[model samples]
Target: MSDKKYLVTGANSKLGKLVISFLLNEYQIKPSQLIATSRNPATLQSLADQGIETRAADYANKDSMVQAFKGVENLLLISMDAVGKRDELHTNAVQAAEEAGVKFIAYTSMPNPDASPVFFAFEHEATEKAIAQSRIPAWKILRNNWYFENLIDFYANVLHTKAWLTASGEGRHAQISRTDLALAAAAALVNSESGKETITLNGPESLTTSEMATLINQVLDISINVVHLSEEALEEQLESFQVPADAIIFATTMDRHLKENKSDGTSEAFEVLTGKKPQLFADWLQENKQSLKAISNA
Candidate 1:
């Protein structure tokens, strides 16, 4: 495995970049053994300058995916950022990897894909099914829960409205950071034994919207009320923020799922993989207080 080539698709993404960081800084893997791919290879010039090969692997362009994946022994398939087109894009990419003789894969997926009520989870579930049906020799499913950074959106909204509006009644989310999830992905790709494995990675604790509001008030030293709304009212609230229609629908749907405890799963997979406990949400907020303040100012 040391000599095998590792390729990360969507390498310019937040999660992808962090995965590369752990693979290099933490694992000390040489750049020559890594390939970073994106639709525009030029965006990865920084990684290219670091001696890692940068390739054009467009999800919409099958030929590029096929050529870029050639000779890749292991693949880290970051989910496509294009929400509506993801299932098709992921299917094409997976087929390309199989045709390129890539034997192993590690996929970043949503928690409880098959059952999750989140709109995007449908595509992830489809991709997982595709991988299962394929002939890939080994695979790992890294089912990452929500990210703490998502609260930044809430922070942004609160900065304007001074209130947190949500349809999520009593549900709490186990939100981990992208950095921790990326480390878990890197570990699975570089170190895990060849087999079928699915790791559900989540934050240490679940916190409801009200609890999140309290955290914000404590961190920012400003009182902000959590306004519970019906699903229809939440849509109107999101619309007031000028949120795009599709995003409003997505948010409301996920909020409904959250109300049902869809995002409430917590696991020690991060500790098991990295030999360290995941950071607490409160601690992450404290550490990023400066940034959070900046967001408030923005």
Candidate 2:
């Protein structure tokens, strides 16, 4: 058993769970050395059953965070699910970790947090700043790109309407898989050599919105068209889809950033950290083709 203890906040979340699974299954880290935390401990019963410590650590509850971090040597502060309350919640987590004397903190942040037009980037930047001022011995910031899972949100529309809409305006994205990012986080946490680092995790290749749509169609054996709209038009279209107004605003803002080429870059950071190339979009689509069919049929 490793002497160090790891606490993963939001351990029940999709990315968080993947990170925990990778840490245990891939790295061969002992269950006793890991602590999985969620707002509801019931959601993490499996981890508890496996001999991993589980705790109900709500970001809004400082005392719960404090208790969760007690004796923890490293912390993986997965960003909170609650969108608006992220800054406050993250701040509380940092404070608790500092209070607990955690030696290192690995934060899941977003791409180009300092200049990202994405509203969520602001929260990540704030969290990074908080971690910097917390007096922790070490910190690693994983600025992840858009997850491949996000493609599913537009999958149905692309299948049915044979069209994909975007405000990106031909801008490219170096999309990376959530699993890949999770694995990188696990490797960084487990490796004592990482020290304090800020890594931008991205896919091996960058592709434009239209190019991505083409790849998806090719992999699914379907025909689809890419529709690029101005930011204003995209907002109106999103509203028509019943997307919340604030969400539309945020999406448009991110689109503007993409248009300015703020999110595009070929980074080997993922491979460097995990010692393997990040999975490509077409390959992921081919692997999950059946699931896409099921969702489209349903």
Candidate 3:
């Protein structure tokens, strides 16, 4: 294997932070060989304190990304939260990696980005294509299923509102904890196999919002009625929570995705990659109940 270093972009993000930890702890990767990049490098104090090199890499500034990627061989391109700007930002980052002579990329993407009807998926599709066209020799497109973490705030909100509201009518999707996804991504980062691969990472079970709500109730020891809404109604509910207009649209479209598609595969892919079984959703929920309760009270 080459002695070139591995790097993570969006280092301060929720997934990025966890992936770094897994790489350092579980993978036993030396801090000297890992770099973390964020637009606001000052916010990466935690990573820096661990002796990992932290650099400024702003997606809006391709030059900055190119500068930050120097000497980096592998990159964990955690998708940014820039709704409308992901394609442009990620394409530039791929180009920047090439410009800086970086070798491989492992991107966290939504399931079926090319065909999924989710509003935010087109950019992922574009970024995937950009990576394929790039000069970088190898890549891994880790198409991550919906994160169970997406519901933490919603569960918290429902704890207060007493209603689990959704527009997805009897839709089901395999969901996994964010920590498992990080472990998978970290494994991909450290894997030195030199070929293009696309892996769809899904949880062990497909679950509807209602089923999830039941699990939530069991976890929190409280009752929450599952209320189905029209997509329009769902948007209104999101607005009432002060969610941004764009995010409201995104949430509804995700419901459509869940209602329409299936078979993203099971946790075996996660186990194969990480050599560990993904934590069961119920188990995860039980463990995180205190945090959910705290959010509810917030």
Candidate 4:
């Protein structure tokens, strides 16, 4: 582990930032042992100030990845935030990693990427295939489920209006915190035991839309009713809020998939890897109450 070099792409992203922090502060890893790359290296000045290597690596540009990944023994290819171009970008990154002599690659992927009913699964599935074909010495696929933080907006809006709107019906999701997922990735990268394995990192418990609302109410001392809207109504509401067309379509489609139980999965995998139980939604909300309260008041 001492001899291996680690690189994390999308270093400016939430998961990437958290992973780097976990490795450096929690694991007491040296700054020289890690490399952080983003499309704009300027965004990573803080990491650079900490003595970590910061470089420019855009997933869409193979040359950038090749340069950023040079001598990197283990690489964490975070799935790009771009929706439509992910497959091409991921392929380019994997190819560049192969060219740069990266011995192992870890990919952040969605739950059941190959067969997920959700609209976002195709690109993840494609990225996984590319990694397999890259033929790096070893690889690990981290199929992370939804983040509990995703509901912050919903909770904020609900606290403001006393109503939580959703098209997802009673579908339940075992969503983990972004911090927990980051810790798990860091655990995998630092430990020598992880290789050629695929693990689903999920929250300790699953909760439905109404159940989640209840949890929020419990923590924040606010009661919000879950209003189940039809798909058309949900779309109309999102459009009224000026959400982009693509995002509206994706959210509605995911709601349909949720109704079919697409995300109803949970595991102890995170605990196994990090030696700590994943944060429960209620617990996370409690820890983050001040921010949520501020948002609610705003």
lDDT of 4 at 32: 92
Q: What 10-residue stretch in candidate 3 is worst by lDDT?
A: 153-162
lDDT, candidate 1, 1-298, per-residue tens:
3678999998999889999999999888899999999999999999999999999998888788989999998899999877887888898888888888898999999878888777888899888888888888899988889888876753376744577778999998888988889888899888757598887898888889888889878887777888999999999878997999988878798888788887787667778888877888778889989888777766
Compared with the true structure, what per-residue lDDT tens digits does model 4 show for residues 37-120? Answer: 989999999999999989999887899889889999888888887688798889999999999998888889988777776677
Q: List the residue pairs that clash in candidate 1.
A: none
TM-score of every model versus the real structure: 0.95, 0.95, 0.92, 0.93
Screening candidate 2 with a backbone cut-off below 3 angstroms (N, C-alpha, C), the clashing residue pairs are none
Question: Taking the tens digit of each residue's C-alpha lDDT, what string does model 3 give over 120-224?
Answer: 889999999999888899999999987888777434567777687778888778888898999999999998485898888988888888888888888888788
Given candidate 3, what's the lDDT at residue 67?
A: 91
CA lDDT, every model vs. true structure? 0.86, 0.85, 0.85, 0.85
Model 1, position 194: C-alpha lDDT score: 52
* TM-score of candidate 3 on Cα atoms, chains taken together: 0.92
Candidate 3 off by > 4 Å: 232-244, 262-264
TM-score of 1: 0.95
> How much is the lDDT of residue 82 in candidate 1?
71
Clashes of 4: 0
RMSD (Å) per prediction: 1.7, 1.6, 2.2, 1.9
For candidate 4, the 10 contiguous residues with the lowest summed lDDT are 151-160
Comparing 1 with 2 on lDDT, the higher-scoring candidate is: 1
